[model samples]
Target chain A: MIDLPHSDGGHLSLTVKVWRQDDADSPGAFQTYKIDDINPEMSFLEMLDCLNEQLIQEDKEPIAFDHDCREGICGTCGVMINGMAHGPLPNTTTCQLRMRQFKNGDTLVLEPWRAKGFPIVRDLVCDRSAFDRIQQAGGYISVGVGSAPDANSVAVPKKIADAAMNSAACIGCGACVASCKNAAAHLFTAAKVSHLSLLPQGSAERKDRARKMVAQMDEEGFGACSNTNECQAACPANIKVTDIARLNREYAYASLGTSD
Target chain B: MGALRRLLMSSIGKKYVMGLSGLLLIGFVATHLAGNLLIFSGSEAYNTYAAKLHDLGALLYLAEAGLLALFVVHVLYAYWLVAENRASRGDEGYEIGYRSKQRTTYLNLAPRSWMAISGTIVLGFLIWHLIDMRFGLRDNVDPTFERYVDEGLQSEDGRPLFLRYERAIQILQTPVSFVLYAVGSILLGFHLSHGASSWFRSVGLETHGLGGPLKKLGVILAVVIGLGFASIPIYVWVAGVEVGDLSAAEARERARHVSEQALNQPVEAMTAEDVAPAGSPDSDAGD
Candidate 1:
């Protein structure tokens, strides 16, 4: 990740309201931190680093947060800022959110992604491993990579590949969970269903994948989709709600044990 | 009997009860409005119309009883269905259930889902309506049927209470009441927009060539009901005329002032982020 140079003497100050929780099943509360002289060009994560450094200097426990790769691809840096997922920029991840985007004296309200499945871990951090568990339930191809047939030999249709790519665009950020009125994981589950269901190699386990993923999704205490589409708007990848409808159809058909 | 029991227990069946009872209540409103409009022709016409209904005797009583049963069934079913839906959703913030078995699939139609949300809002407005108009001040007749039947009048301290029409006019003359009625009617319009057509589809009435006409009828009914209900407050506001014996011009001015205030009130915009507070218990903090 490129660290842009700070302009105008590297001085930026703002108030941040962050959610703090010690562990799962523990009560949480908001803690306000007054950050001063922050670098305007620094990414949102880097700004958090500056605050943590100050805390460490003061001999206090630094705020715990999550980030990996400092790139948008990892989907690890998820935060709700001033009521929006990944700050104000549409389709932008928190890692890409720069301090320059915010003005001086602006109050930033930060929180973890709210959902029944995602329990609070600590300050600004959540246990998104529920998503990982759901994915592990049936989100992969059973075919061996080395012994696999050639790409062209499989003969995938252009439309199928395009659809698969759309589903594959999902980074599993859980914005859908935070945005949804029911905190449903339909978008994530549907994207996974559509991704593998569209591909030829994954067809063998298609029914099992749908069943297992949906069952696991429910087991995680995620709400059912009332088709609010807030998830679609909040999604960084802009995953269509149509994919959710497709997931419903797939589940319905799969439950009947028929492809048609 | 078993099939009837199943129908009563199902979600669609509860919706059917609501629709059917709603239609019945709409019919009552149309008849009541037609009767009330006679007041413009003078008290004799209005009183005679009331007397004619009273003269029906046992038949009128039976009809009243039937309407009461319908209202009870509608209210009970609505409460039960909403409770069931809430229970099914559990702790989840929202619930999206499969409606594949239902004849008219909301999955295929975008507007249908929008209507469902609007319907919930309208339902809320209706509850307030029943409290305000039916059970509260509008029913000038005492809750006890004995006083209404014996004297053929609204009783107050052992005397025949005059100015039944005046009481209604006073209630309607309030700006807050007028605005509430207007807003409530608008919600009703939205409810009927989706509901009218869905009702026919529910009962299998939209078959063959009847679908087009039935849909048109639905739209017409929605508009007519919305306008009919809205006109009560609008007429009082526009005419600025007091009914019966209440001739308080000051009250009329006060009503107009309130109406203006209600009209001028600014509507607050609700954004997604504004719904839940930052770092609140419900909000997710990225860990």
Candidate 2:
């Protein structure tokens, strides 16, 4: 990923309101912090690191947030910036958001994803193990371990191939859940369904995949889709709500065609 | 049946219910609107359509029962969904300075956020409509409306058919009823606009090629149904077409005159054009 310069001008100073919680059982509140001389080139996560550095120097507990890969692909790092999932820049992840997006003296509010399904673990961090459980429910094909098959053997049409690839792009980011009005994980679950269901090899388990994943998603206590399309807007991977539609179609067909 | 229960009970399963039921209701609206449009064709045309429905006896009742069941299912599931969604959203909201900057295709919130309110408004309107129009239970009764309901289309003694067209015209001409119908029509339109696109999404048809057209179709259907129904009341009020407490023969003559004048043709010409199956009328015009 290209690191864009903060600006042609100078460094930006920002005031951030961040949610602070000791643990899952504790009630969280917003804490204010003023960080000065923030370079425009630094990513949003990098800006958070600067504040954390200052907290450590003062012998105070540093603010906690989640991040694994600084790149957008990992889907580990996410925060609701100014009420938007993954910050204000559309389709951009938190780690990919540069300070250049905000002007100096900007006051930004950052908070953990508030959802019944995604309980907050600590400051700006939530337990996302729900996604793993939902994924474990289906989200995969049972192929015997063997040498890779020839690429031509699949014989997927270009349109289907492109669709499958697009659906496969979802990184299981909780941004969809954060942005959704119901905190619904339909978009995320649908992406997994579409990715595999469209592939010829995954056809054997396609019916069960949709049913089991949906059952698991519901079990995780996510809300139903009202089709606000906010999930699509907030998704950093650019996954569309159409994947959800595909999941619905697949589920209906599966339920009708097979007892499983 | 167990599988059906599992599907309907789950989150996504409940969505499938919303999508399918919503589409069913949309179909009902389009058909209902078509039947309403028959008012312009005059009494004989409209009454013949209503008569055919009434004449079906048990089949008509069965269809009505099915429709009522659909309405109950749709509204109950929708209410349940709204509650579930609210619960999932949690109690905490963003701070005062927080604002959403995400780009969206449509700027209007009526179709997105006003769903519950719009749905409630439409539901209220539906109850009032059934009472006033279907059951003939309103106070200060137009006795002519009661006659239409009691007698099946026409009297056995060769009296003219008490055409539904007249009651429709009379009710629409009243100021309060007209306003209510107009508002109800518009609110139902808003509901349909969101509902149409949403149904497809709920069913998981989020493919790129189809989503845009589906969204557009939803808006178009909403406009057509909303404005089309509103046009009737507006037409009645503006034109000052009075169908005041007429005798059976007089009502028939009035119906024939309007139908002939409007189309410059006989009622048979229009009825001949209606190719709907025996009992359903123009319901199957399109999905």
Candidate 3:
């Protein structure tokens, strides 16, 4: 007997409308799928895997999606389910989103992140290399460790370390971009800027890092922040707009030619 | 010049300009509302304020020039910023627009996505207001106000002389001007509902416990300014307080009474010229 999470001991059927695009240049459309016999215990990704397996059995092309560890740490898997980033589960990745939130007869619409900087690669996958380019631009500390240091060599204040750790939790997922009204990269960029600028080790290049990264972000065709905090609301990492405030502080000081 | 160029070219630098300009404009509107509210005190107080402002001559013009410059800078930068932002979002938007988590949705929310549309309406209304209220050769004005202009107690130099309180009340009660001002104030309220608080965050003023309170403050401020400004027109229209109903003669009587009270003269002893205001220029054109 098959397992079911319902009292009826029957299958859960769902109507899923998934975006299908051939490549970056090709136009895309929504293709509907009628999925039945789904176990309510399956994660959202597992449900997608079941559908892909069914497609393979029918001699059709399996849908392409990006994921590494199904545990949601790699920041690889993401999709818009019913217009919400990461499938309507607040601060939870798509891989971790349980199918229980949805009912059996529900219809889900899945699409990739939409932004000029993020063009669709195939179905439910877009190029986020723009983020890497921004990170490389200056979202780094120039100081070298020269091997391991003693435990007491660096003593970060508890308050400051807590702030840094909070901002450093950003997973570079494009949810911030996906849910932003302007598709701006303020949250992601601010997270990196705040994480490094809060620490003593990153003080040397802090000013230039803020300046270069902001410039690179603008160059990548990302929009400006209107400060709606939509990104903060949609983020899986729970990154706050206070981090953006810190980035603004850093950018202002950098523009003013101030040193640490 | 190099430093100025860098400030203008960068995204954050432009935002700093936007925030500063927007805040200054808020200051202007607040003071303007204070002065405009003097109409409730009766004709004499309002006219004295207007006459004194007009007599400031060059200093008043200088302040007006500065305000216009701020407005121009705010509008121009907004234009460029919006254009670049639209270009970045690509030709296609999400079939569904942005919606955030509703936990903090108890906060007074303005449609942050509709800033450009609301701002455009406010701009149009401002231009129409200048034409309707400031410039002469207009329609449906207070009869005594037309006499003041003819008597050279006021000039047609675009200075609004609320010499008779009816001058303001009458204009507000007009069919077109009333709707225009009402819509303008409402859209300005919409703009400020989100923008009033967002400017600080743009300028990096966020701290612990500040965001929520500032958002609440923005909503309160917007309601007071926008709805408060719109209410006067609504009041006049509803009251049907028109000018032709003993208004012109009443303006004259009030002017005479005010001047006599200031000079402490008897009604029988007071001359006709005593009704002319101290700050008002004598007749250059006769009615």
Which prediction has the highest lDDT against the true structure?
A: 2
The 10 consecutive residues of candidate 2 chain A with the worst lDDT sum are A1-10
- Please compute and give the TM-score of the first chain of candidate 2 against the native first chain: 0.95
For residues B76-138, could you state the per-residue lDDT of candidate 2 as single tens digits? 998999999888878876565323444453333547766888999999999999998877677
Whole-model lDDT per candidate: 0.64, 0.79, 0.77
| TM-score preference between candidates 1 and 2, better one | 2
Error of model 2, residue B246, in angstroms? 3.9
lDDT of 3 by residue, A1-260 (tens): 11223424346799988888899999888888889988877888999999999889989878888787888788888988877788766788999887876777888888889899898899999999999999999988767856766886888899999999998898898898888767889999999999988988876788988988988988888988888787887888989998888888888888887544
Q: Model 2 off-target regions past 4 Å?
A: A1-8, A57-59, A150-158, B96-102, B105-110, B140-143, B146-154, B157-163, B204-206, B245-287
The stretch of ten residues in a row with the least summed lDDT in candidate 3 chain B is: B261-270
* lDDT tens digits, residue span A15-47, model 2: 999999999988889899999989888999999
Identify the superior model by lDDT, candidate 1 or candidate 3: 3
Write down the worst ten-residue block by lDDT for model 1 chain A. A1-10
Q: What ranking emerges by lDDT with the best candidate at the front?
A: 2, 3, 1
Model 3 in CAPRI terms: which quality? acceptable
Q: Which ten residues in a row have the lowest lDDT in candidate 2 chain B?
A: B267-276
lDDT of 1 by residue, A115-221 (tens): 66787788778788889888998898775645757658889999889988988999998877776545778889889998998888787788778767877876787
lDDT digits (tens) for residues B1-287 of candidate 1: 65455444433345556667767776775676677666556433443454345446589879979987886786676566555444433332211222121234345353344554566666677676666544454444232222322333322123222222444455667777789777777667656655666555443233335655766787787788777777777887888856543223322222222222322211122234433356643233211
TM-score of each: 0.58, 0.85, 0.88
